[model samples]
Target: MPDAIDLYDPDGYVDGPPHETFERLRNEQPVYWQPMPDGTGYWAVLRHADLVAVAREPKTYSAARGGVVLEDLAPETLAMMQDMLLAMDPPRHVGYRRNVAPQFVPRVINQLEPRVRTICREIMRDAAERGDVDFVHDVCAKLPSQVVGELVGIPEADWPQIHAWSERNSGGQDPDFSSGYSEDASNATIEMAMYAIGLAEQRRAEPRGDLTTLMLSMELDGEPMTDIQFGSFFVQLVTAGNDTTRTMLSSGLLALLDHPEQLAELRADPALIPGAVEEILRWANPLHYFRRTATRDARLGGVQIAEGQKVGMIYTSANRDAAVFRDPHRFDIHRDPNPHLSFGTGEHFCLGVHLARLEGRVFFEELFETFPTIEQTGPARRQRSNLNNALKSLPVRLCAV
Candidate 1:
């Protein structure tokens, strides 16, 4: 019936996540093997505990072996991804992660509160003046571009181009966003990489007090990062930070409007916004899944996985695992003990976790403080992609507080 459930189809999620299909798979086939269009297949690890185990044992389940996506990348692309921390194996991954981990720690991230608040204040004021805007691009997407560009020391005038490249890099699956993903993504990556390399070259001769300068001064394994290495690193931070932050904002607001009582509770008590952000992440994780290749033949969730086979930690399914989260489907602002794997776990856990949480908490608090009420002007439109579970457009009308 309907060729069973084609999890690989990008069109499958236009309406919403195939929750029924995922739930059935998690129940009957926790270690589900789904075939791909190219005759290859992958084991979808659909349970929360199973994913954690996979994430924990990096030696057994390797992110570096095949990069972190289902599609087989070109040999050049695979090599390029190996340079980024996202796909690097341990030892090397640990070394690279340690170099810049200080910037993301709470102590440093906390200092940005006033700056973040200022950014939100400007955004809210713009929303109030326009009264009607596309929350996705016009409002939510603007913050990450400026914040990330400035953080990296990119010239202020280039923020918009950098953001456009970041959007194309992540939005390849949707036709509205890109005509063909391979060329578009590759071109975007090349341009951004070149820009990063240029920045590194310029900073080498004339350094500035910014993250770019920090990265240049930092050493990995007693050696400085090469220009190519820096380019890949820069792309990972810009695209990853921009895409996920925007998704959280747009998708999170839709979640609030969909449940007014919860929204009211949040507005009544701003202190609860932190927990609300966690719930939003749990309920609507930004990415559907991340791929990891089996280092050796092994067993997981009672299923045998062969060496080099594609294994995906399906975050969308695991976040709703009944065994983990009680009443998982319901949107509750006070979702306690929420151990969602949206930021992942283990070595590959999102390094930007604290910064992302801070952005979410401040964005919502500022939103409610600046607007007495916010209403959806139209139906929310989601990006048509299996990988990026995000909204492409969210129209809203704001009433000033």
Candidate 2:
């Protein structure tokens, strides 16, 4: 009660993260407890090392016991989440990830450059025509939705609907995006799942060389995945791929524009774009935190955690932990050996990290190449959500060279 900081309140994050509070918490109460409106609370692991420790020991703090969100989900939803890569822990996570891992490796994902570049090129071209636009939905989001659709064989006509579904699911905490976060989520999730089921059935009847078909062909624990499993997996891939990638691109551009010198450096040498992407992720991470349920009594950051307690690894705080980085608060694109936990660490590390990185690098390179003159047309408005640290609207005016 002393600090009056509530991590659970989405309104508190409407403007931006309370860094001063996090800085104070990281120093004083590295392991902070926060109460929620629903009479339940979570242990906020704020430091860099503590987050890594909690993430590494998935057995003690299980992602499957409860879904990866701060709030508890309904029974049916929790069950569906248990099958997601975000919720699985240990042997099961290991098994499923192993089968799907090869598809996302740097080597394989790198091959997506030409196709991805073409997509970005077209997107940039369209944005260039509209000199003034809301970069969030109009420009930044197009590439990911299109690229993910191509990757999963989702029909070109359905990409807009798929993107909307993903937005509703991930942006539920924002009332502007979702009328009722829970209801919208349930509806969007079911709609997407049904679509995935139909898509899987279609692909099963006529196999193709696409990610969806590859996923269908994969088996977990010596058994082929059920249609339901395929549906859940499809939701995970599309939502994670489309939503997070779009956020990264939008937020990354906003970060660069905020720091014109950095943007200038990036334009001068396109090679620096990769490191710029890493810095952007570190400074402006897409998701704020991922939750885990403690399975047994354990001590983390010198605080005792009991069984059935919800624990959240606050990536926003961890990325800026002074103990980890020399200038944690500073946004330096060339921050070497940057150990930001944006993509996360260990077993549940983001499956699309390589793809995200590729998109960031290519998108920026194309943006700078195409738009010789770009400036902020209006103030950027951030999404009102503790879970999603992203922009709801970024107004920019760009002129093509």
Candidate 3:
């Protein structure tokens, strides 16, 4: 009905998200059937309400049954993904999340504000020194890498490697970021997991007051988390934390720069930075969608979905759903009751929501304070990936205050 929309093609997302296509799909076919190259296809849950319904009913729409990606992953990779919280179904998901959730609660995350601010200050100082910089990599990527490394007690020297592996893992569709080989992506995950396993072993022998040690000490399903489990959990935490936070910061800056008046408002009253962060998330959600498989024959958005069919909770469309946000296209920092599904919903909601928000707020605060003038030096480049709604490069000039 919508002129053969191809939501599965990574090429379609090279410039940016197919928001126009998404808008049309939401209007005509909220539960659109999108065919993938592999003959199998998923029901793209475009509307906000429908996506929520799918997410709420984990038993009906299972993450583990097919893993989270639209394409079928290799058996080993799928096994690793199943180990991560994102791809697990309850009550296993519940047990594992319960063990580590305490480390990420707002009260605990708030305690890291001072350190996050320090890191942001350092990043801003470096960006100010390099007046012209690729904001995506030089400015935005540094904070998450450092923050996650510190959080997980990763060796300072290994941070860059972890970041590189993360990029490869998430950037498989982007040739610039990835080698364009599926094996490379899988290898990156395995390599990271191996590294994480070693870290767990080291931390086990010499416990430290860090997340790594805490996680290793925690019990899942009435037993201590094994090294393999820690490896999967570590991979998820580092990769998710790094890529999503980088996207948020880079995209958030571009959004503010595009709307100078809103940017000015943020600079005038830094208190509004948090609200602006939410709007940024709503506007440019880092990940486009997360895949789930129908565990049984089910009906969603008036369409019948058979068992084993993939279902994608398309956050890009849902965030801009007219039914949810009034004037959803407008980038308003003060959008109260902003219920964007960027961090997802239900049992698999993001574990690092507080940390992500804190990083966003502090990074913006320090950025505006450090650089009074931020100008776009060149056109921004979006990542070529259906899953990752992130920028590949954002060239900008920053003038220090």
Candidate 4:
């Protein structure tokens, strides 16, 4: 088994993403078959071009067919997931996304910058008061929770509960974040969905000027969004908004610290923060991969993928593809034309892309400005999950300016 590499094992990711193995696979077999513990396996698409090809042709590689994870979810769970934009295919996905796209466009997202910056300032001030913190939970997690909560018009008091549910949903593979039972993860989804359903009911009666009200008023397939559909969509938005942004901020800090020269450069020139965030995302993408099932037999990277087989567009590998990225392994804030697939591509590109970039840019700018000296106090711990490439804990000391 010396030559064997298990991409399916969550434990393999606890230390870090298996980049060395990924490089080897990318070189030898860009489209490799990986076996899961459940006696099933997937074709891991390691090359950037191949992954993009799979994403572009959604008709051939359906997100709705089997849902977007390697493990087949429970029948009910898969049904609920199918309602989300991430799991929907082109024609239907297009309509659902179009209904809400107005809310997340650059103009709409830019309007929230001042609020986002204010949230960052408050969070940084709180972190400064603490002096030392588990940066992941205490610092990085707050901005997204508040931003998303306010945008959705969820009561500020419920933000923590929403954050908790989001963590459990994505951190099911990590014991630090979830109970060993899969039921707990499912329950988190159900609980969040129920909360959303109640909120939708309230908004329908007394409409407000928030995304929730906008979504509730909008129609999909020429019919108003049903309560259950709203519930599913809410779960997707909250979970994606909370988890991925938190990961980006925490992981971005760690990446900056790892390269102090780059960190200093950013501090010297704050204008570089936006590019730095992009590089950080490319280096440490929040999601490792999203799954899609082949609708019919097709050839990918010269390999035959049979119908109904799971295919993983391995972003972690594709981000560092030597063919696309010059000096791929080296972290550079000024990596121009860095076409990383971190936010994905094609029809299923991230809905909150603008908001995420805004949060990232503002959070780092505020963090550096508020605390002149920020240093890691201890070892960073990573989440044990193949799907979520995230840090579980990052201990740091923030010295106030």
Candidate 5:
């Protein structure tokens, strides 16, 4: 008889936390088998240690083979996605990661805290004056687009277009969330790539002292990145920054709302916001999981995973793994020695981790400081996607201090 594997239904994970089912899987079948809607099933690595092992052994488990999603991307789409840093396999992945590492290093991101604060203050001000606003659009969405626009040489005026495109690129997975349009994600990806190509062409003539300049001048394997290459890089940075950071802000607020005492603690001691940010990341990660494919047949956590099969390193599950965190359900902002996989693990860890954290810390600090009496005036709504676990609407009212 086949092993009695704890099977989790993906539909349960779409709206929000799949705590009960995930808890059962974690305790009973740490390496669970989950069925896909399209008649396929995959082994879910539910334990934190197993996830680390899967990430570390990239030679056996690849990001390139079947692409990251449960269903394989079309050949053409797969080729385009392979150009992304997240999807590329080693030697190339290593080289590209190294090339961009200097730009996003901790010290560099740390310097942007003041600028981040300014952006957050402006965002808070715009929302505060309204008294009531859709927190997702008015508040959470601004910092990401602005930060990304500043990072690249994109003009501030063009931010809305970029934001729209970024939303579309990440949105095709959710028909309801993405303007109720059934636009193909591949088309959006191509459009974004083309937009970046134009920007690269413009920057090539007169290099500004910004990230666009860096991309234009910087060499990849002794060759300066082509316009096509810059397109891939631009899409990756823009879309990743757009979706994930927005999730952080929106979800972080939800966490605070759920934990009143912790929220009060943060208000009393603003210094605790730093640790609170870490806890937020741990408690409610922006992404559900990042999928990786196996290059060769491998055994992970004693389960025999077939070659070329897609495997997801579920940060959502790993962050709450009983072995890794104590009182895992509790949101303790003051929790120390917290090591969460919100940014991922291993060499392929998120390059924008520091910047994301800096933005989160500054945004929350400014939020509490400016609006002392912040509360959810209406019901919160969630996005409809297994991939993007975020709020669609948080009806909030903030009283100006």
Candidate 6:
């Protein structure tokens, strides 16, 4: 047995791959108990099948009970959070997500490939000229913000603010990323919502050919989405799109760097880029887990969970569960039939998944094509939070052909 107490500190393995700890937990404690910094505790579903069962039965496992984190939010904060799609239960959740889902359909997202490529090329060209750049901020972060910006019809000039707000919203636990507390994060969220509300009002007055226009014109249950609703929705899309895609590209590069053989194969055959992207999602899923509360007593993997108890689909552990994945620890770019739960499963699968995939495939294609001699120049810095499994810094030297 490993010396580490697996659930003693959930944030301990936030920096790099926690394969060792996760492996031990999967074998010994599939439903590990984690005591939070507060007096609260939760059941971490550490196996693949168990996590999927939790997500599949939303009626039994609710996202709305006590909120989705190990540390329960204040009642007011929880009320504020209910505006987000991820926090809603069925019927309401289904309606809201469905309203926005059509815009993110595979066909619609596929059409953005050309624009994604252009953005990636511009970012790469800029980095190539610099010779050395912080890959996370200068290169990887740009793509998602630009993509989300265009989708929402935000001006290019406002992209920086949007990025900053998204960072603050997701970065509450990381002192380096935010003011380091929920109050600050809440304030940032309010500011972002207010900003989004202004844009919504403007879009309502004169519709533009963009997502903001579509959202402003959209109706949920024959009523237009309130400014408060739009605010939460905007924050979710921008924040979710920003950090997760950023991690995919930045961490994907880190993975490629670690495995030069796979990198070479990808370089030799760019068609493998899409397959490689899937492998990256499998190998470096950006989230540790997402929480759900059991509405009533339930049995998962023969373990009983009571009503109002917090339960998480431990994606990090599930992605590497030996039951679901052969050689689960290996980083194989050619691995077919990948069943990673990074975008999640069942009712709450990420709406922006198609867009994320497009950005990943196109960005890497441009990255490999533009910079034939790219090398990691320094160690990467990880985001300091259990919630966001992301890199804060990635230093690389690029040589443009």
Residue-by-residue lDDT tens digits, candidate 1, 1-401: 24577888889998889888888888888998889888998998999999999999999999999999888888888888888889999899998898889888999988888988899899989889998999999889977777777788999888888988888888888888877965787778889999999999999989998898888887765788788888988999999899999999999999999999999999999999999999999888999999999999999988899999999899999999999999888888898889999999999999989989989999999999999889999999999888999999999999895
Candidate 6 regions exceeding 4 Å error are 1-11
Write down the TM-score for model 5: 0.95
Sort by lDDT, best first.
4, 3, 2, 1, 6, 5
lDDT preference between candidates 4 and 6, better one: 4
For model 4, how does the per-residue alpha-carbon lDDT over 1-401 read when each residue is reduced to its tens digit?
24568888999999999999999889988999998888899999999999999999999999999999889989999999999999998799998888888888999899999999999999988899999999999999999999999999999889989999999999888887788745788899999999999999999999999989998887867898898989999999999899999999999999999999999999999999999999999999999999999999999998999999999999999999999999999999999988999999999999999999999999999999998999999999999999999999999999996
lDDT for each of the candidates? Answer: 0.90, 0.91, 0.93, 0.94, 0.82, 0.85
Candidate 3 lDDT over 26-89, as tens digits, reads: 9988999999888989899999999999999999999998899888998878988998989999
Candidate 2 structure quality by residue, lDDT tens digits, 1-401: 38578988999999899888899999988999998998999999999999999999998989999989988998988888887888898899998998888989999999999999999999988888888999999998998998889989998999889988999998888988898976798789989999999999999999999988998998865899888888999999898898788889999988888899989998999999889999999999999999999999999888999999999999999999999999898999999989899998978999999999999999999999999888999999999899889999999999885
**Where is model 2 poorest over a 10-residue stretch in terms of lDDT?**
1-10
Runs in model 1 lying further than 4 Å from the true structure: 1-3
lDDT of model 3 at position 140: 95
Query: Regarding lDDT, does 2 or 5 come out ahead?
Result: 2
Off by over 4 Å in 5: 1-10, 179-183
Give the local distance difference test score of model 2: 0.91
Each candidate's TM vs. the true structure? Answer: 0.98, 0.98, 0.98, 0.98, 0.95, 0.96
Residue-level lDDT of model 5, residues 90-202, one tens digit each, is: 88889888878998999998899889989998998899889899889889999999998999879888899888888777766666545543346767778889999999988
